[model samples]
Target: MRPSIKILEEDMKEKVVLEAMEILEEIGFFVENTEAVEILRNAGINVDSETQRALIPADLVKKSLKTAPQSISLYNRDGDFVTVLGGDNICFDPGSAALNVLDQETNEIRTAVTKDFVDFTKVVDQLEHIQAQSTAITCSDVPEKISDRYRLLIALIFSKKPIVTGTFVKESFEVMKDMLVAVRGSEEELRRKPLAIFDACPSPPLKWSDLTCQSIIDCAKYGIPSEFVSMPMTGATAPVTILGSIVQHAAETLAGLVITQIVSPGAPVIWGGSPAAFDMRKGTMYLASVDTILMDLGYVEIGKYLNLPTHAYLGMSDAKILDTQAGFETGMGSLLAGIKGVNMISGAGMMNFESTQSIQKVVIDNEIAGMTYKFVKGITQRDEPIAKNLLKEFDKKTHLLSHDHTMKWFREELYLPSTVVDRSTNEEWITKGRKSIGERANETVTKLLSKYPGVSLDNDIIEDLTRIMKYENVDFKTKLDL
Candidate 1:
């Protein structure tokens, strides 16, 4: 049997879904976009224009769910099938839209600039364990209006991997689509093999903003995959209990689903979220709290029960720096999510409760993901009687090292650590100057950036992108010499 983890029982999952439907029917969310409200109204749902509240019937929610695909496939820039986004297929990417990065030179958090996006994308593109690239860090140096599309443009230039990105405002969504079209050379080709998936979030406490609503409509119209990231801080923006927060998340996500499916019947949508608990004493949010992990696992079970692709904000640390605390939280959360078969887990490079991104953290998390992937492979039964062959080998050699069985099994059974994880003798460590994981990570970052292997875009396509950038008057200061 394949490795897996289950938190909610069958009946328990049903209860959560029923409660979510009830919440939708009674405490429906307010629709910020007039078009979205009209869509729901046309679908036989009740909409009160005065309150901006659209009461979604349980049947409508069920119908919308029926239209959502259970799986999605993402393609790379070369038009090659890369990763599937559903079932037990787990994928990991760096965090999205962080304001700052942990500088390797100063060892301090600083506002991330345009070069930071280029450098970060270069590092992520090289990490084997990181399945997709995200807008890892926002470019503070770029114009505020173009920052979202600028980050996507830079990621496309520097990485061949499929991307996970988002735009906060509505107008920029079109600009981002234009950029993708410019790179792909046509709108139909861009839709056929979309290189990026956009994250559309819902304001908590049963609310939807105009910008996010419009983004959902636009993404669906263009056939782009949309990930519904519903963030509910328990005890603050949502119910204090974990289960309560989950129910609210379900309702919020279904509300977005209704809007998307109504706009475009067969557009792709992911059952995704990033729910957390509010730390009352610290007056802060904890995405790495133990409760948060449980919430992620629980909600993933709900998504599986509903037969939808899953995504979660996991493997993140509340701690400001990489330390023992960061290690334990990230390792446990990542391991659980992997075993639970989350389709895509974001927040690999995040720190300080999603406020910062670190390339070193990305490196360390890559190793963590490697270990988790190994564990989720589980053990195999190569032979009918497992101990019989071992007994025969022991009788002959007193050790299995020289046996054919050992040679065949050892390679697949063990997970060797990368250079970032030191498993050396004390003397060897001293010989190598006893560098810490962080120091070793810095070395890895330098080596990867030095030999960054970005895909070669056609000169005409590059010129088209440049023309778009120049026409928009956006600055392009990213260093791509490597």
Candidate 2:
């Protein structure tokens, strides 16, 4: 049997859902978009005109849950199937929208440029365990207005993986959607096989902004998947207790679900979030704290209870730099998320309370992800008589090392990591240059980028993508070398 972890029992899950629905029905959620408000009103839900708060009943919540898809299929830019966002199938991608990058040479956090993002995409493209690419870092060279779409453009040019991206404003979605259409050759095909999932976040204490509401509606209309990222800071923006914060998260996510399902009956949606446990003494939000990880796992159980695809911001650190603290937090959270079978695990390379991205950390986290995947597979009986038959052949003259059984199962059972992880003896380490983990990861990054086979896009498609961007008043030719 596959190993797993659970925080809420069957009855506890039911209680969480029931309380969430009650909160939505009584307290209501603030909906800023007029279009969204009208959609809810048309669906027979009560809405206040001045306040824009919609009172969604339990029946509406149940209906929306029924209409929303249980699974979402993501496709690469080349129209190949990548993975499904449901069940116990988990996939990992580097975190998104970091303002700064950890410089390899100086080991200092600085604003990321186009070259930095390019190198990051190339390295992630080569990593074996990181399943998808994200609009990981914003380029300081580009204008703030075009930052969202520009990052997506860079990711598409360098990697073929499906993207996990989001819009910064309402207008950026159409331009980004145009880029996806250009890659897929047509809007119909783009809708048929979605190449990306957009993240739409809800403000804590049960609120939805106009931009995010519009994003959910637009993605639903185009048949693209939308992930609800409800961030609830315990004892700060949300209630002090973990379960209380989860209830708030559920209410906010359920509100978004109602909007999406109302816009399109069978629209695809993911129950995802980036909630953190608040540190009152430091007045900081801890992404890797034990309380925060427990909250993530608990909410995922609620998502599974409702039979929806789930996601969370785990496998990240609160440390400012890459150190023992970074490794300890990242490994613990990542392993638990893997065991719990979160469908889309983000925040692989993020640090400093999710404000920074580290290339070295990403390389090391790739190894951690590999081990987590192996651990979840668990151990199985390899032979009919268990180990008795193999023990019979394990004599003094012929050791198990030379036996056929050892040769057959050793490679399959063991998860041999890359050079990013140290597995050498004392003498071997001294002879081969005792490099730090960061040093080895830096070398791996350089090697991967040096050997990366660049993506080849058709000239026509490239021109189309460029034209779409140029129409938005940003000239890529002047700023970047295409």
Question: Once superposed on the true structure, which residue ranges of model 2 sit more than 4 Å away at CA?
Answer: 396-398, 471-474, 477-480
Cα lDDT, all candidates: 0.86, 0.91
Best by lDDT: 2
lDDT of 1 by residue, 394-413 (tens): 65576777778779888788
The Cα error of candidate 1 at residue 426, in Å, is 2.1
Per-residue alpha-carbon lDDT of candidate 2 for residues 49-165, written as tens digits (9 for 90 to 100): 988889999999999999999898889889999999999889999999999999989999998998888889989988888989999999888778888998888888889899999
TM-score of each: 0.96, 0.98
Residue 447 miss distance in model 1 (angstroms):
1.1
- Residue 211 in model 2: lDDT: 93
Error of 1 at 27 (Å): 1.8
Compute the lDDT of residue 259 as modeled in candidate 2. 96
